[model samples]
Target: MPSTDFLWWRDGVIYQIYPRSFADSNGDGLGDLPGITARLDYLADLGIDAIWLSPIFPSPDVDFGYDVADYLAIDPRFGSLEDFDRFVAEAHRRGIRVILDLVLNHTSDQHPWFQESRKSRDNPYADWYLWRDPRPGGGPPNNWASVFGGKGWEYEPQRGQYYFHMFYKEQPDLNWRHPTVREALLDVFRFWLERGVDGFRLDVFNVYFKHPDFPDNPPRLGLRAFDRQQHIYDIDQPEMFPLLREIRQILDAYPERYAVGETFLSTPQKAARYCAPGLLHATFDFTFLHSPWRPERFLRAIQDWEQALGDDSWPTYVLNNHDNPRAATRYGRGEDDARLKVAATLLLTLRGTPFMYYGEEIGMRDIRVSRSEIKDPIGKRYWPFYKGRDGCRSPMQWDDSPHAGFTLGHPWLPVHPNYRHRNVEAQRRDAHSLLNYYRSLLRLRKENSALRRGLFQPLTFEPRRLLAYLRQDEHQTILVALNFSSRPVRLAMGRTLSAFRWRPLISTRDEPLMPRDGFLTLRGDEAVILEREA
Candidate 1:
């Protein structure tokens, strides 16, 4: 079991804010630190314990803020360092923890270290980034492919060599093998810790150290060039273990600080290994994010995560993020909110920390981006087939005003067209709105210890259309049942649970049907959480 003592992150909900789209203060068309500071009360009132802000460091915005040009400074486009300081202060005043995204695996090509390293091979910072001479056949040194597209190695004419970049060409991979490089990155962590940051969300963390020999990845059958290879040599090297330990040590020095990593091309088992006494506090498991809305698939994903992580390790659940399409758009039927409600019920009532992407509570849908208005390089390169991530990265719809009250000026990306009727302001007054449902669920989770720290036991014997699980503790036991189908389901309580008297705590339907005999009948796309004294 996890520690009995209170750990804020383990029991809390983390609301991820894509800073560029959250709110635009000063009519700048882009969200900034000041804008975030102005909205701290809204987050606190929403009942989220922490806010995970995406990258706001100095960058050229090639891949948004992921391409960091300066690790120690804030980007002018977002705000100055003073603005970040104020944001932290205001968030803490409202009893909210703040975690920043640390893109340690790579740096922007425009970074000073990379600029000097590329000038000459013998410079002091020359070894800071991965550089290799062309092969005898005058081609890339290895067969590794960039995640964006094409070869991972970009030729640098000035240095007469190729630099490695697992992502976009503007972002170059760092050489973690070098002691100087490791120390420099650690210092970056220290800089933030000293500035009152609570934790870090490590980006592409598992790929920090590639194979030393830079061998070619074995080929496989797939659509993208990157997917055609097994990625054995390009990512998830053993060297990353020690680096995680070092990062954990730094975080431990600061009280109540935490770190969570993003694992690339990893399974539940791989993600579990990253969390322990000396590593990350948690790692995101994308099993549910990639799976279709099926009962068996979700059950298997949850079971796989529970079995792999054991009883001690904490797990994280996410249905939407900056990289993926909106969950409502992916799961919703035309004009029906039942599916989204069911999804939200599963996310909040599950036995782990739940991460909510901005606009998810309002049932936000992805806005289609025209080819001419596309900003993502991946969308531009793979147009007509892949429209890119701009759909989910649109500005948040706070109200029914022009641009959804996100900004006085034009938004960086278009607001969802449905925002006029489906926004936060309109939903605030509706008792049955998705936003209100989410708020109620969060409040319930916060008040119930069994829901927050209970042991999860899946009712595997249930029918394929029903997903049932029991979260129990010494104090209370809660039964969660979700119907994935569009037809009513009469679910058996199973032999193990039929003896107890179940009382309804919350349900997706406006009026939930109580348990009759040993079975509970649920409407299409409905869910319920029932409590029984332990």
Candidate 2:
């Protein structure tokens, strides 16, 4: 089923670069488009085919850049629209595609569309947003809670109505039912597509529409009101399909354009459905992000995804992103990158496209931001108990220099203290560093067909202690074996695997796999990839 022609997205590795934390060219303590353009060489050399940037549009920073006020303009804080054009041109020159994160779910209340819509109920733009009358005597329209805090309905005093916001109040969900809203948002796609953006990573696209009835979501057990509800009626609506088809039509009008979605609060089944044929090219499944450091956990995640995306769609996978803690911080034991190397091998060799988060290759850990230093709204709202996402959204570590060489001024978020030893500059010099291991695996992935578009066949011999699988695409079959524990383990697969000769391709360990001794042993926390030799 592989296409004879080149498909950059399907075959290439997409690196997620959080604009606010990637690099800061202006010494203003913030990362910007110019900073990203300057770093293109680094990304190209890192073996990534494309870069998926987080939103850089004009925003009040309520949800960072997710609260986009204007669709066409780039935020002055992140440089102007001119800077973005240059960045795209420079990225394309380096053979690296650019994908922008589109916040299709909502727009900042500061947006002219929302501002005019809230002017009065009779205004032409009044129906642009989901405005409703208070239930009885002025409670929210329903018990639906915002993903940030309180009720999803925010009262608008001037309009004598409540508008729905799935996230913060500053961010209001657009009424997809309104034909104008649909056309306006679809035009956002065309705007960027015309600007030569290769594709889009739709932010919370699944939650774009809610049930027309506006019913109270059922209660569930959780600390925050947002998570306390089952989120049934508020998400995964039927109307999304037609809208997706329309979005697909817009993208298909352009050559080689791609679109992937971030399915907010989605399951493997729900996420996979959005990737069906013409709807979306793929959807981000965060199963790997939440997975524990165990073979059984990853095995289950892989099988569930493989089964979910079977035949109908291609899949997308991620280990970490701006909103979550880094994999190294979550799985690595006391700065040890052994666990990370093992995880990277699994991610890169898998059949689907893998998104490597910024600073992940150097194994950057989450920096703890105390209550006083917390900047993220999500973190600020859930402080003490949850601490907030500022820990994960810290600036990218570049060198041992002050502020990790991210900026001359103070970073908006604190840089991890480990930058002295863990920054990119330090790791790049170490031939056996985690950064180099990623480089090697990425190179191996490109060099091997089975590792790219292959069908996954899980090896369940040592299901709990060792994770193993075969990736076969017609020509070559690659066996990826990883020892999940801290102790060495020997492969015990039956005659099916024993029939072939495994020629070593890559390994996380210092020495390559020596399999001629009639037994294959995986050193502690090691991952090895082997190809069948004819």
Per-residue lDDT for 416-447 in model 1, tens only?
88989989999899998898889999988888
TM per prediction: 0.97, 0.97
Provide the global lDDT of candidate 2 against the true structure.
Answer: 0.88
Q: After aligning candidate 2 to the native by TM-score, how far in Å is the CA of 384 from where it should be?
A: 0.6
For every candidate, C-alpha RMSD to the true structure in Å: 1.7, 1.7
Please provide, for model 2 over 1-534, each residue's C-alpha lDDT reduced to its tens digit, 9 standing for 90 to 100: 233655799999999988989899999999999999988998888999999999999999888889999999999999988899999999999999999999988999999999999999998899999999998876888999988888788889999999999989999999999998888888899999999999999999999899999988899899888888998898999999998998998999988999999988878999999999889999988886799887888888877888899887887878998888888888989899999999899899888899999999999898877788988877777777787788778888889999999999988888898999998898999999999999988888887878888899887643777898889988888888998898988776566677777778888876765664455788889998888887
Model 1 stretches with alpha carbons more than 4 Å out = 1-4, 460-462
Q: Which candidate is the best by lDDT?
A: 1
Assess candidate 1 and give its lDDT: 0.90
Score residue 126 of candidate 1 by CA lDDT: 93
lDDT of 2 at 28: 95
